[model samples]
Target: MNMDNRRYNVNARSLPVSNALHGSSTVISELEPLHRRSDVVLNEQGLPRHSGCTRLKKLVHKSKIRFGTWNVGTLNCKSVEVVGVMIQRKINILCLQETKWRGEEAKDIQGFKLWYTGKVSARNGVGIIIDKEWKRNVVEVSRIGDRIIFLKMIIGRETVNIVSAYAPQVGIEASLKELFWEDLEGLIRHIPQNEKIFIGGDFNGHVGREAGQYARVHGGFGFGELNNEGQTLVDFSLAYDFKIANTCFKKRDEHLITYKSGASRSQIDFLLVRNTDRRLCKNCKVIPGDAVTTQHRVLVLDVCIMSKIQKRRQVVTPRIRWWQLKGEKQDIFKRNLLDKGIWESQGSANIIWEDMAKKIWEVAKVVLGESKGLVREIRSLGGGIIVYRTKSSIRRTVLKPYICVTMRKIGRGTVWLRKKLRELWVKLVLKLLKNFIRTLRRRKESKIFIRLPRVGKENQEI
Candidate 1:
């Protein structure tokens, strides 16, 4: 058997291979090094060879602010728990629906502050919870009934208006749904175009997975099928030029579904922003595992503000002890003014008022020094009134003098005169009793006997 010789004589045959395969192999080889490297290598122009199709690089230095929306069913005893979750998630601002907390007020839980609005009955409420850092930046909070609330805050140079809306459920009355839409539209219309608007809430409508006619507003990444209620939401987005952030990014089914109960799951809750500012959103998804509620999941949106926030510097301007002018410092100040020849100066008539004012201020500074701290001394002829030097302090001083004058006028009336007469009568009766007791004790010391006056049985003679 010569099988070894036959195998050596066999020639290899060439087969047709596609150029695409060859090119892909070369591309994969080139990308192998990049995949192994932890950092991307910049090209000659100082940009990655294959930069992603995103403008996020421009905001590399900016910080991401996480905003979330959740339908908690009822905050009742879970407010602290909700805040705890928010802190863990690092969400800066959170829009809440179905708060079930009555009244319109802000409550501080841990480091978060919740501004909620509701009616007398504990149902269908909305609120916005902001972290401690952003609490001071809040300029206004507008509560519209129990279903809608608007929070305006300054972030860097931009004015951000966050609207928390709870739309009527799918089976709710038609009139109520229309009213909600109308109110929402009016709110958006009133917001200045230059400001950033973020409307986050439980919209209670599924936008579906298909954009169809709503390609501009719906991002085609939603869950479930579109219904009448969903159509309304899409139309609203189209009218307001808002991009439904929930459907903007592709994600797994679990991450796209916001509401799950029993055997049903859908994407009713949504986060929306102006279409023009869509690029500012880095990511938006439903956190399925971090469940604050039984049915609804937290839908979070990461927004990167491109503007750099400049820290405000507090200028502590020295305040003159003007109250001292009412005391001995008055004479000293006048003498110093005269000594400085500020008013006696025969300067040119063309001298500006600023220069003359400056000269007077200089003389006053030397005579009555600036206040040392918050404490200010207000001297009267009788005594000194020490109070904190603040606007409220001035208000109190003004009101106190007016109140004293009012009391003086009132004291001259008949009622106050009767009160004074009653007081004087009590004092006279007590003084007479004391004098009589003293006389009796002196007489007893001299062993003198005195006959007491007879009186009625009820008032026995002493």
Candidate 2:
């Protein structure tokens, strides 16, 4: 019942109910708190031993990298919500199918960049969204078509190729399906053997729970029954020497099923990785409780990758509280400067200025204190947190002669109020102009009628 021991229940999800009562992988030995040193546990050999007396054979020093695939169905007005899901779930990269955004360029959404490929009309669009931190490392991006997009990034010492694809549905024409496979095969064959590859998206297939002769490509933990489309996926994986990561891990029915309807459930989404780097994957499962506006649930794959640590630069500036020198404080500064043998001054204009400045600095250090350190942080749209430490306060050192004279004549009483009112007026005018321009553009795009002549009417007759 304790949340701190939730990992104990995690292991239970893998074991059968009968195995839990029979102590298959775990022997509680004692029901007391887990921190107790005297609590004895049984090892694999059925030998009683203290919990702390044993050590694990290996320790993995890797970090988890989350990759997700989702058939969002449409991305017209769902950019914010979809990006929010990626951030909340800590997904490093996500492949979105059926984006429904008509564009062939990359755009910013929240703290992520969406590299989408689609035609003028919104249909069969595919995109890949990556964290802003990784954007700089992307070396190449190829927009194959509305159904496929490729991106390559330099991760550590290795180059990783990520392919986001949306295959034709089962009911599509056979020629289109063949063309999709041909394009996919060309992409795979072009990549070097040394680099890592990850292909993820909606394959629209049911691989079933049997590997048959394609055991190297398909794992036995698949969901639903194998069909012709699934066989095509298996053949493609075998040809490219890739493994279907989603079918490698055993999960509950809810986790195994990726697509669900009112009463039908199946798995159509999948993730593929190189067979040699199979150990890089830690787990693959489907996440529930998504908005569920679409029938496809979110499929996630956990991979291990090297962590990137960047050194941050800190800047500090010196600040002096000039306002502290007033009345008696001003007189004291003058008296102190004079006392330091000011009568014995003899130098050129520059030398005299330097000496006087040095003396003033020493005197101020004794009379007034420096400003406290202030840290300013700015969150960038690319998902990086940058902090700036100011060493000194920003003080105006120069002003126009007219502005200074006006301030002196008007006094400080109404200066602040006048400045604020002027700023507000400028802002109001700018806002009105912006709204008018926006309305004009909208009307122009919509071809709304205006009291203006049509094309060539000026030369002809109105």
Candidate 3:
């Protein structure tokens, strides 16, 4: 028989690690084929068993960082007891706004680890909440002149950094943009190239590419404030390439909403990071906390999940009796064959072609590889895989774009940095006042409450 041997190419980055590991773990489930293929991955028994990192260790350890950001209708943290309740449930990164506290005042809370960076405005407080385990990644914390405090947290084994910020609303007309960007510019500049950064918090702006109004699953309405920020926020995001993470839709089949206020309600809450880290965002979700005290909603997200792949496999034929086959009715094998083009009707192909199964196996293998290539796309960008149980770069290939940010128009819109940043505090103070007025007008018209589950409700699964 004439043989045509071909070399198979494996892109180091695009290798289906998730699927390969899955296949290895599923050794017992491997089905033997009518024709055998040559490959060392097979075992003495002709069954493919897994080995080491090749065999992905399947696990269900919930490493979810239940994080969210909210404007907190008022400066009253005490009113948002539901937030604390949500924390007890599962909270890793919790950002609050309208905190109305100085940095010293925030220090009094015990047990619960907290970091607060406040602006001169009455309610421009922003901070990051992390479990004791992740808090160690905090390389530095800088206070933004009592207006806002910025924290840079290093993501586990990633070149990407996390920035938690609360921008001031009040500032002078001349240098407003310059002052804010100056503070932000330094944090990103310090991080090494090829490292990504997810700067999320109440920037009070929706700076993302994907477009959709703030939507809530319940009652044909949205949560919080959804007023379009226009280009002010968009321009800044474009200049710096900060992707808004709110593009992911909430799974509210029936009705699930987080916040409500006035005639028009919207979801201003966020759980954002750079869109470049889309791969790292294993499973992003927005969950509401059952809290009655505050007007803002809660957001939940899961990060860092591997992908799934299904590999085409070939093995020797299972236990079969050639003598029994000889005794069987001639039509029996033909009747048992799958009718979905399993066997070619033309091209001189027949049920007794003996090698027909081998041809089918070859087709299936090619089809499987083509299908898997779609699921496994990380190789398109320059990404690498690190060997497990060791700190070594094992495989490298093109993966998706990492966090490579390029900023423009350093002194475009806001106040210039040449002047004192504190002088621009007027802008934030005015913004706080406007927000307070907006809140008062809305509260007078409606009553807000958290969603408490009723036992009699239909199909109520948590």
Candidates' C-alpha lDDT: 0.72, 0.71, 0.43
Off by over 4 Å in 1: 1-61, 308-462
lDDT by residue for model 2 (39-85), tens:
22322233223232122222223556788899999887788888888
Per residue, candidate 1 scores C-alpha lDDT tens digits across 268-349 of 9999999988999999998877656889999999999777635334343466767567677788878776776666545577
Tens digit of lDDT per residue, candidate 3, span 44-146?
3422232111222232233445555555544455534634654565766566666665553344233455666654446556655555566666676666654
Give the per-residue Cα lDDT of candidate 3 at 73: 42
User: With candidate 1 superimposed using the best TM-score fit, by how many Å does residue 447's alpha carbon deviate from the native?
Assistant: 99
Better of 2 and 3 by lDDT: 2
By TM-score, how accurate is candidate 2?
0.55
Top-lDDT candidate index: 1
Specify the highest-TM-score model's number.
1
RMSD of model 3 against the true structure: 33.0
